[model samples]
Target: RTNDAVKTKDAFRNQAARLGFGTPNLLEATEYPLTRLTQNWQLLNSLYRSHWIIRRIIDVVPGDMLKNWIKITSQMPPDALKRFDSQVR
Candidate 1:
């Protein structure tokens, strides 16, 4: 059964941890593929939420100020954009 399989997997993980085979953090356990998938999913969900929040904040900005800000940013050099992107990330 699925439940038995999960229990067996957990038991193996616990035993491995007891023997110091891996980190105690379940999310960092690469032996389980689901952990990576879960981390990626969480990252994507966080990005989606951040994008939505930024859009809402942009909507609240005054039209003229927003336009001026966009124009200034558009005039920025590629290096400047890269630095800004890194800082944002």
Candidate 2:
């Protein structure tokens, strides 16, 4: 699944490049800026969008949508105030 995700990302970058959208640099675990990206507002917003549109709305067949939402949200830290998993300090 991880490999499949990587391939999808690669395909997205390639397709974006082909379509004249500038391909933003891909983030990877080893990259020095990976942490910055993982904590980025834009990326987190996109993740939330995907969570809504893809995870819930599109994949309506999932048995436990709320649990799936929590699981996906908990994977990332509080990148933005809207992040589902977070604590106020």
Top candidate, metric TM-score: 1
The local lDDT score (0 to 100) that residue 3 gets in candidate 1 is 54
Q: What does the lDDT read for residue 56 in candidate 2? A: 61
Q: Estimate each model's TM-score.
A: 0.19, 0.18
What are the runs in model 2 whose C-alpha is more than 4 Å off? Answer: 1-34, 52-89
Candidate 2 residue pairs in backbone clash: none
lDDT of candidate model 1 versus the reference: 0.60
Model 2, span 9-86: residue lDDT tens: 433336544442354544422355334554687876677576766446545556555544543434454566454355
Off by over 4 Å in 1: 1-73
Candidate 1 residue-wise lDDT, 1-89, digit = tens:
36554334443345645543463665555574344544686776666577987556656766656564532358888999888866754
Which prediction has the highest lDDT against the true structure? 1
